[model samples]
Target: MTGLRERKRARTHAAISEAAIALFLERGFDEVSVAQVAEAAEVSKRTLFAYFPAKEDLVVHRFADHETEAARVVLARPPDAGPLAALRDHFLDGLRRRDPITGLNDVPEILALTRMVVEAPALRTRMIRFQEASERALAEALQDTAGVPALTARLAATQVVGVHWLLSMDNSRALLGGQSADERCPAAVADAGHAFALLSEGLAAHL
Candidate 1:
């Protein structure tokens, strides 16, 4: 169980993030300043910076929750399950839930955040960095779990990360183009199945 101090910290962290995102969505990411976010959150600039080291971080920190998610999925797979199988199943599950991380969510807030990230150069760049960190985490997990060499693990991570990113991008484009998540569900599932099948075939020989 979390202690009172930890719970309070979590609440404060969430409050800051919520305030920052609301401001960014309303006034635009670039237009909103750090001081303004701190004021809105009712925290000092020092406290806000303590929670988020950078302005781009205030927007991108949500992505941080999933930075090591792929790695965790791989590590926690059933004894007989292959890494790719676990990952594919996890992503499919996310789609079923309309997970915002899967880019299949049509929630207005999620759509606004996605558009904001796409339009803001800094956010885009920071998101790319998050992707890079995710790839690294997955690579390490692959190396540890599959006992593959570093180079091979890295190569596999690159492929897996790229495929997932492309699939998510396709989903986002469909929704942003006016297609609902329910309408896009079939294509998204089919695409995931096909992509994972291709990956399984390629990775089988290597692993």
Candidate 2:
């Protein structure tokens, strides 16, 4: 059945991603080839490429959900919810769930992946580029849902995404600095909540 096939595909994709991340953490991202990841996952290199077009994607696949999430939040916001308020609510919910995007899911493997990305120049460049693309997608969604001016929507999207990027980097730093997940996650959640509140209230007050 179509549903069963989709579920199987999802499982395969998750297995490949998990295997790729483990290998990347063991060997540097640059040092690990697609062939090696395929071997580790027990899939053909062609199959791996069919699932993830690029090597960087294998490590950063989780981030591919952001654009969809941002769009969904804006689209599903209550009638009374402003764009900023909707985003704030969404992020707060994510923080409470300790979502990986919010940096509250600071597992050791995630820390290692963060370190791998930080140390790799190419991965860093690609990440910035990916962020820009995600921002554009979010901006378009916000503009559609909120009927905001193009410039304003883009600016708002940039600010929101930038804040998220900062929180993610901060969480990684805290973890790498030897903080326990239990100790660091709550602080990151608090910081993210304060950050979103400041954004909602207007940055002029904080700046």
- How does each model score on TM-score? 0.94, 0.83
Shift in Å, residue 155, candidate 1: 0.8
What is the C-alpha local distance difference test score of candidate 2? Answer: 0.80
The whole-model lDDT of each prediction reads 0.92, 0.80
Candidate whose TM-score is highest: 1
Give one digit per residue, the lDDT tens place, for model 1 in 51-162.
8999999888888788899899999999898898999999999999998888899999999898898789999889888889999999999999988999999999989988
Candidate 2 residue pairs in backbone clash: none
Q: Can you write out model 2's per-residue Cα lDDT over 1-207, one digit (the tens) per residue?
A: 999999999999999999988888888888999999999999999999999998888976767767567767877888887767777777778767767776666666666777888788878887897789878887888778877778878887888888888987887777778886678867887888888887777633211
Model 1: CA > 4 A from native = none
For every model shown, the clashing-pair count is 0, 0
Model 2 worst lDDT window (10 residues) = 198-207
